[model samples]
Target chain A: MSTLTSHRTRPPAQPETLRARRLPAYAAPAIAVAALALAAAIVYGAGIGGPVLVIVLGALLYLVGLFAAANAVEGRRAARNRTWSALIHSAFVLAVLPLVSVVWTLVSKGAQRLDADFFLTSMNNIGARDPNGGAYHAIIGTLEQVGIAVLITVPLGLLCAIYIVEYGRGKFAFAIRFFVDVMTGIPSIVSGLFVLAFWVLIVSPWFNDGRPSFSGFAAALALAVLMLPTIVRSTEEMLRLVPAPLREGAYALGVPKWKTILRVVLPTALPGIVTGVMLSIARAAGETAPVLLIAGGGAAINFNPFENNQSSLSLYVYQQAGSASKYAPDRAWTAALTLVALVLILTIAAKLLARRNRLSR
Target chain B: MGETPHRSADAGTGGTRVTQSHEWPAGASARVAEAPVSTRSPDGSGLGGGGALPRARAFGAERAFHGLTLAAGTTVLVIIVAIAIFLIAKAIPALRANTASFWTFEGWFPNDNPPTFGIGALAFGTVLTAVLALVMAVPVAMGIALYLSHYAPRRLGNALGFLIDLLAAVPSVVFGLWGRDYLIGPVTDFSGWLNKYFGWIPIFGGDGPYGNSILLGSLVLAIMVLPIITSLTREVFLQTPTANEEAALALGATRWEMLRTAVLPYGRPGIIAAVMLGLGRALGETIALALTLGATYSISFNLLESGGNTIAANIANRFAEANDTGRGALIASGLVLFAITLIVNIIARAIIYRRREFTESAA
Candidate 1:
């Protein structure tokens, strides 16, 4: 009642003059359409070529036209606002064009070879003139290589997260955290180089005769190097998000910290951890450089990752595209599409799972 | 204690607990076997509510788990150091055998008997293309970020943001394929159009062949980097205080003025960080430029000519064919690329770190 009385007793104040007045909302679109039409006509009449020219002229005209029209009707402040708004909107449109174009191009070009034959056979013996071949070997290589990478990375990543979250203290923990971040900034090619120098040049050669050898396991090792930081970062976030009280409760009951984390924490954060792992897998799968450097791209099927060279989808795409054959481009496009599809599927699933976890929690 | 009432219900275990604690020295087991008293029930919420974990817990099991986790954590440091050491060990021989200045020469002939090579052209191309990419991408990314944060409806902004993130996830190799195959024609025409109109400008001065230019490579890189900058700047913009916005609104400031005064200033550091991160990505980008560029090794500023090469692209293009010295020179170049990226990433990290106080408090 008192609050109502206070509100009723308040006096209405005089309004002050403001410099800028907002133009009617429809003014923007009207000006944009008129400017675009004029730009299109002028370009067409002048015999100017390319959609880039048309789009650029149209956008420039729209900004000038909107500012002028608004200035005439309102004032300079409003005109400036109109110009900024137009520019912002045009910037968005420009940024979106390449994304739309890339996807459309991929789908149109890739759909040509996304057939059973594309998946069922290998390019082992396919001639430059021949149109029939598949990424069977490459697909097998990708799966085996990525599987090995995951196997090596996940355990290491989980343990690191467990240490950081459960037992790490002060400088040791901070050093670990800082370096993990630094590790993420290492270029994928550099990781490949590191593996090329260390694994293929030194370690794998030990297993074989003394001569350097490139193999899928070396590629997997490089991928694992790329993947570890990503997994650690994601697992760290998930572990951190596991409520502290759960740990305190477990500790109170004389549950050893490791058992508490294993039985209580990991289960709660598992969905998020899995999502992170999936994303890392997606990133690792798309890498061409690491595989090219160490895996040593091959044409035929090679299931043994520990021994000779193998091919991955990305390596295959690079190889086929570089082959300078007419049909090679088709094979390249299909392999790229397949890699993209797989990565996108994993990414989407991971994102959806993350969203579900957020909502459920 | 709250667990006292439940203790009688589990008296059968209570007898076993006395023997367990007696068998093991109380001090030796740390907090594990010592917690059967009043500690478990002090805070009242025990979801597990089990008879205090048996005497077998802690000690050996705890030490082993911590050791394993610590080892994993330590591996990150080990790997980074190992990479540097190995790169140096491989690159030193090539550096020593160089008959020419390794820093300034334009050509790469490391496979020759005397091994004459330099990273000047490749390094210059790397920085130039990355800078060009940032020039094209940063403004547009900022615009899209502003649109998402300020102009678009909530649902539309979210959908568009998701689409942009999807674009980021598209593999670089895919972008390379698209650029080399599909984007080449349009780029060729655009190059001609620019040269015809802006021929007086040195960058747009090239005549004759126009496709596979630095402009094309940079444009492709711009497209690749767009999402990262957009998403980051959007997050920073969204972090602007609501009170600050409302104050500007109450003062009858226009939307643009409000954003200029409040949001942009607040997001400046974040934007710089985002752009630098994008630059890092563009700098080290390999396959996309490898396929898009004409694979020349010169230091020209021309954006219309069919010529450009980055260190990463060169490595990818020539590594397979490279002899021992050639591979060593490539590793040397890789070291340079690594240093550049490390500097960029560290600076970006420092920028973000400067605002950590505000963020932590706000959270």
Candidate 2:
């Protein structure tokens, strides 16, 4: 008892100290600046590079400097950690460069033709020398094609999701799910080819009196095929997220299974479903190959989707970019910008709606 | 532990009650007459209520809904089968008409009399460009993914991740446009520099006129697939067990060492899956390659030369002016692309599914 008391009464021992050494916080920034100076001197003074080269060389120098300095100061392991950290950060920066350039180029070049004339008029009568053509018809075509695709895909996809989530069992359901995954990876261009073969080559020829004529409706068919898997997968996820307790509660209230799913599950998952639908729509709208293949892109303003050829913004961009005329590139840029804007708007709105969805949380 | 015997006893009683109800009269009216008595009691209640409940009257509606949904699900399968069948049906005629050795020939002249065309060059370019793009993209994508998942602060990571997702949402056609007009100059200059510096290497040994080359197309493809790989790998990295990470850190391992010891080993399958998925995308990319590649037809290995073509790009470029035979030939090429991507995706899915069991067990 005396020994225990003496030990308990002894003063607290000194805290153990860590032997690991760390560099100062500002060391990184200082080395970065030094590396930049060295790289600038080597690249610019030699007249062999530009800003991009300087940045690249500077990043290399910084990595080397960081490793050397950290190794001398903080030892090998810390040096490796620091080097890897710098590399990872620079990797992100390197990726951001192309993305930023893409966006900046679109805005700068696309803004040149962002005018009322470019928006309101069709490219029907625009000559090779004319700079006043617009994607009015293409915009209309994209909307109609995408709108029709949405109308076809949403119900089918929703029902498929319902089937998979609520009623699915055993191998048939597994096959459906597996194929859906496969279908999701089907190339957009291949989807276009499918439609071109099935619809434009075979089915639409019946409607066109033995001649295979392209129509906006054909484009809609291709887009529908592309949009189906995306919608089904997303809606399936959303449906799965609808809690089991909710279904159990509905069942406890004597609601039939179908009614429970229709009244309870669908309502709970609706916002998420809409978000998925909108996302698929955005993806479908940006498709160029299918529209290029089956729609037989027209410059004229033909509003009838089932009757005649129609242009889409993507198709228009592709067309204008390939055209020999000098004015076409500007039009291509503007149309590309328009298509991107449309897609981005839809995607953003869908994301926002998804965020608001209770089921998502 | 206390409830187990009680629950099992209740289940046994319930099973006996279900058997007793099955022994009841088969008539609906009789079952309905029996429902109230069984429902009123605490024991054996709801056993007869199974078939006699009002909800049973809606069975027809339930079956109809189920059938409808089942039909919708089946349509997905039908669509895939139809794609393969229709593509073959169209391609057969074109294949039969080909006079040239379709496997070895490099030129595409399906429009000519007797129609000589081949997928040799296109397939070569497709695989080459896609492989090269993956080579360029995978390391950097992994780096960015690691940064997002482990390196960056949480809020910064979230914001940057959102930005990367938005980058993915940017359309392919827009990327094509940018690559054609804006990126071409820099890529051309870079190509020249590579040719000048690395001219001794056969692949880099090229003369002038080096803008729309395999290098340019692969660069654009790399950019396009970077976000996909990064996002996927980031998710995988984020899922690294905190216990494993802490174990490594507790061993006095530095961050990089911890990643190498803990995170990477666990995330290898996921990384491969992501890379293969990216490869799939790069293989099937259309407009971007169409706009960027020089559209040449040869099995060239020169990365700095302005000569490369892919199956999808060739289809997109030639589909507009293709005749019956030409369209069929292009569709044939599309068939080849479809098969390639299918294999890639199947392998990716297999990897994911294999890993899924491990992860599920681990969790």
Candidate 3:
């Protein structure tokens, strides 16, 4: 209300005049005292064990001090604003705290053994007694499995999205949308069970019997199933956004519709397509259930998708963490952190690529 | 037609001006007639000409490409359908062979001489935990979405949204570990208080050690799903038509009233979609449930003390250890979960479709 009054009284060019008229420039010390008290409470909480009652009291006092400070500085309205802002900041902090704690725990514990050997050697010959085992085979399996999944899903998903957005008219589009919606919500374990039951029991019962069973191809197929829906939805939106004017211009030059969609539309929408694909990749990279069910944990480093047992980072984390050995479990924490780091790296890479493309073009 | 005069007072100079001799409105029709007909058609000989050959060839190629794209897309659909059919077929013999009821039985001791399995406990636990999560999550999630969309400063909101998105993308296993190491310890005390105060209610009537219980599992799930609902609701609310909000404000409505009247109604379908999306994540969640729910199979309604198990968690826990029959039983349970999610998504799509129709008709 005071702001409105001052705005009406003051000229437009002199905005500072309104601030000077409405707000008294005082009460800075109250804010400082509140901050000091908050700092003291944090330090005391860090140093000493307190009764829940005392802690609650401290928190209440801290909030009251903040309210009083804001009220002194600006008035009841500013105090309310400060309170709401504090609540929002608290909510944001609450949302982030668990994640921060998890990452902190992983990095601190994982940093102990993330040496050169951790990435180079394999745990194939290492026993439960050994403390220096590594996960090279698992790392390799993760990459190959994810790469194969990407290879299978990208073109299929992209083409399907193109069909839906560009060529789809009515009934066929509705059917496709329904199926995609159904597929999106299917459980991860269902995909796993689907692959396992189909491949192991029904399709080729004898395929993995004589041979050591782990195969990257099986894992890749499962992840591909999980990734397809996300890819299609995202890519379809990107393709749909490619302006009709570009296609019409191409048509005016006697270019084929397919050629126009391919040459002009896709090029315009390439960055979004890449972003969608990368998001799928990021999602697929961390999946543990389907990979576990399909890709039987292999010990040795086998990069070939068709070959015997290969392990992924997720499976490796599960394997080690679930094992009886203390050292392997510790290493599992490290491996888990390494996997998180790898996924984060890929995400950052995708963002950078998208950014570069956007800027350059 | 190409021989028509190209010059007009307006076109030649690229300006709209009236001459002393020509009144503007009167000359409009004259200018339209004086425009060259050749400029109207970009194609040579505009229509019904031998030049149509190139156009026909382009159309043919396009048609073939369309066919190819359709075939390619159908291949993906075929793969998905084939996988589902193959699994159902493989599991059918086991499902049919069992003489006992598969869903009513509370036990899931598949490793015994004779497998006795049912989805009673799993289904109960799944629904209970997911409901618990939804109850805890929806208000805070919507609040955050509203704050970020309407209240927070733009830069702050964007930064917060990015941070939340990153948090949402954190792996489930990490959340599981975090829940076990951090949340469980703190939440146990809170759960104990709930039991103490609300024990009259059957849901909270349990013993003190609620550390690895359904309530804790739900809490973990709630935290994990918060970002998803928040981001989605933010988008939905952001897409609310601006004119409606302005109209409400113009009619002497408060900010809250404007949001209640204009923004939320416009975003109803989106909110449903967002909720379903969160529910989908909650339904399929495994690792977090595994860590917090303690993998106990019980049919109790009590949430605070007893350990519970969701279908996804049960399958993950038992799949590798189960023999053929046991695996089949778990797969059957998975089939039930699949049907539930499929139904949910279908309903969500229907709501979105109805929203589209409603908006179009209203317009």
State the lDDT of candidate 3 residue by residue for B1-363, as single tens digits.
Answer: 112121221123432322222222331333334333332343332333222212122234456777777875676668667766866776666576555677787778776766677788898888888888988887778877877877788898877776666666667776676677577877788777677667899888967667888878998899888888888898889888889999998996656667778988888888988898889889888877876787776788777884889998898778778777777777788778877777787887888788878977986
lDDT for each residue of candidate 1 in A1-361, tens digit (9 for 90 to 100): 9997896688634333333455678987887788788888889888876565677788889888888888888888878877898789889988888888999988888899989999989888888889899999999999999999999999999999888877788888888987787777788888899999898887876768788888999999999998999999999999888877776676555455667778888998999999999999999999998898999988888989988889999999999989968999889988999999999999889888988896235
For candidate 1, the lDDT comes to 0.84
Question: Can you write out model 1's per-residue Cα lDDT over B1-363, one digit (the tens) per residue?
Answer: 111122222433444342222323333365444444433344544334335444432345666787899999999889988999999999999999889988899989999999999999999999999999999999999999999999999999988887777677888999988889888998898788889888999989978598898999999999999988898899889889899888987897889998898889878778877887788789888999999998787899998999989999999998988999999999999999888887888777767776676656764
Better of 2 and 3 by DockQ: 2
Candidate 2, chain A: TM-score against the reference: 0.92
What order do you get sorting by DockQ, best first?
A: 1, 2, 3
By lDDT, the better pick of 1 and 3 is: 1
Model 1 spans > 4 angstroms off: A1-26, A33-52, A359-361, B1-59, B239-243, B358-363
Worst 10 residues of 1 chain A by lDDT: A12-21
Q: What digit string (tens of lDDT, one per residue) describes model 3 on residues A75-96?
A: 6756665565555545555556
Which should have the higher lDDT, number 2 or number 3? 2
What TM-score should be assigned to candidate 2? 0.89
lDDT of 3 at B20: 24
Q: Cα lDDT of model 3 overall? A: 0.73
The candidates' interface RMSDs, in order, read 6.0, 6.0, 9.2
Pick by TM-score: 1 or 3, better one: 1
